[model samples]
Each structure stands twice: as structure tokens, then as C-alpha cells.
Target: MSDAVQTLTIVIPLQVKPRGGRKAMVRPGVLALERRQDVTLIKAVARAFRWRRMLESGRFATINELAAAEKINASYVSRVLRLTLLAPDIVEAILDGRQAPGLDLPRLLAGFPLAWEKQRASLSPA
Candidate 1:
């Protein structure tokens, strides 16, 4: 036998389903699993709050201040403080020394005007 030729055909059907209001809005269980792998907005904010409080309380002033007091880099302290602008839960975890490693605090804070506004509004009583 020299050369051989063969032909193959495949058919696939695709179906699209229209969501029915609120039922469609509900996320599947996989979403919960995914969420567990990441830090939520609340956690970020908490971390920021804790850092801000620490700085405000004169606990850590300059880079040298943090280094002398906590034996860490001044730059690292500054970087961590920026997380206070994030959601509270994040800040809390950091303060508690259990935040997820390498979380991008600044990126998390970006475009979160509503979160900031809500916190600010709450501070001002009706």
C-alpha cells in the first residue's frame, strides 16, 4: 500500500439559555470556591484601617520608626500602610498578621469610589 486518504466529519450543537431574572443572578458553588482563594473587599478594607490606626497612634512614624519598633523596613511599613485604603477586612488581616501574601492592595483600592464613599458617609451622622 502506498498512500491512504481518510475523511472525517464532526457535528456539534450549541444551546443558549436565557436567564430568568433573580435566579440567573445566583452564582454557582464554584464561585464560592474561587472566592475562598482570594481576599474579599471587606478584608482589604480592614487591613487598611488597622495600618492607618497604627500610624496615627504614633506607633510607627518614619521608616526608621517602624524599623526600630518592629524590626522591619521603613519602605515595607509605608507599603503596608497604603493597604489601609483598601477594604477593612484586608487591613484587619494584615494587622492580625495573617493576610494572604502578595495581595495587591493598591490595585484593590483602585476604582472603589463607592466603597470609600460609603465609609465616609457613615462617618457623618444623619
Candidate 2:
């Protein structure tokens, strides 16, 4: 018998890229990509809209009242409420799991252009 042994190697094309606040495992060949929803973001977006509605509906007197009801911090509630002002496409990107790198809640809430077009240009991948 020969002393040498044969070995086989298999490789799947993939890349680790920064898609948002985290690094993502990117598979190249797959036509339909599986993107798991960021539940925290989804919840935040939903809460923002809901809170806005409640306030507009006069169900809550102030952020403090809403915070008390929700058991969240009043300041945090206000910050989250600002999420309502985010551009629709930005919200859509978050929902679709296609948000740009570093597009986390704090990053978005920190500040965004008031203009929808500017927000889109700044937030989305070029």
C-alpha cells in the first residue's frame, strides 16, 4: 500500500461583512437570502407608532404618563417616540432586515436628517 493518503476539501462561497451594527455571514450563491428579523428593532418601530397614536388619541397625558404605563423610562419613551419621524424607507429597510451598517436604534435615534431623501441617501448602502 502507498504511504500517501488522498484528502478532499469542499468550500461554500461566503463572506463576513458589516451589514449593520454587527458582522453578518454573507452567502453568495443563494438567490433568495434568509434575513432574520431584528425583533428589538421591530418592537421599537411598532412601539413608536403605537405611542404616537396613543398620544394623538389623548390616551396619555404626556411621555411620563405613557412611560409609567409602559414601565419604561420617560426619557427613553421620548427618544423612542422620535423614531416615528424616521423616513418610511428607513423603516422599511429595518423591517426587511436590509438596514445599513451601524443602523442600530441608538444610532438612528441619536440623529437623522429631517429630509426623507437625505435620510435615505445617508442610511442606505451605496
Candidate 3:
């Protein structure tokens, strides 16, 4: 071996594609999987369900009362309460961090079809 200057080259093989408009590197025939948990959305969903439970269990007399106790707006509380009406599978997906790309607390609060089937169809696993 000589202590002379030498150049080296290296090439790494990878496949990059867009997932939900974000680039991801994946192996052939394998989709890039992201289990990145949306903590904000998860907490919002959990709080919504918990709030609904409080009202149903008679722990809170009304949304106004709950809102006041929680230090949040009644209208916002009302909107969050609607999360309880989401399809079971949708809720499960949310809990398990497997919901569709666009599903989030804001989107859910925007409103959805009251029918479970429609909800499933709109927010099915992707």
C-alpha cells in the first residue's frame, strides 16, 4: 500500500416515489410505509370520545357545561362531539394510526356523511 492520494466512488441503489405527495424510498414491489403517529390528531380524537362519554355517563349535564369545565368554546365542543358518530372502523383506524392520508381532526370536524357506509367509503384505508 502506498500513502498516496486516491479517489474512491460509491453508488447506492434505491427507488424513490411520491407517497401522499411526499417522496419516499422503497424497495421494488414494496410500498414505503410510514407509521408516523399523528399525536395531535390522536389526542383530539381521544378527547372527543372522552367528552362524549362524559356527557353520556351524566358526568356532564350538557355540552355547555363540559365546554365551560374544559375551558373551550361550546361550538368547538359540539363539533368535536360529532367525532363520536364516526364509523367504528374509521375510529379504529384512527386509533391504530392506519387512517387514510387526508383524515385528520380538522377534516373530520368539517363534517361527514351520517351513514357509516359513506364514512367508510370516504375514509377507507389506502
List, in order, the clash count of every candidate structure.
19, 2, 0
lDDT of 2 at 92: 88
- Measured on C-alpha atoms, candidate 2 has an lDDT of 0.83
Query: Candidate 2, TM-score vs. the true structure?
Result: 0.69
Number of residue pairs clashing in candidate 3, backbone atoms closer than 3 angstroms, sequence gap of 3 or more or interchain: 0
* lDDT (tens digit, per residue) of candidate 2 on 1-126: 998999999997888777668987778733233354566877899999999999999999899999999998998998889888889888987887778867788787787888889988988757
Q: Tell me how far the alpha carbon of residue 12 in candidate 2 is from the true structure, in angstroms, after superposition.
A: 24
Minimal lDDT window, size 10, model 2: 29-38
Query: In model 2, which regions exceed 4 Å deviation?
Result: 1-36
**Native-structure RMSD, model 3:** 8.4
Off by over 4 Å in 1: 1-48, 87-126
lDDT of 1: 0.50
Worst 10 residues of 3 by lDDT: 29-38
Which model, 2 or 3, shows the larger TM-score? 3
Give the C-alpha miss distance for residue 18 in model 1, angstroms: 37
**lDDT of the candidates, in the order given:** 0.50, 0.83, 0.83
* Clashing pairs for predicted structure model 2, backbone only: 20-101, 20-102
lDDT score of residue 118 within candidate 1 = 60
| Candidate 1 local lDDT, residue 17 | 31
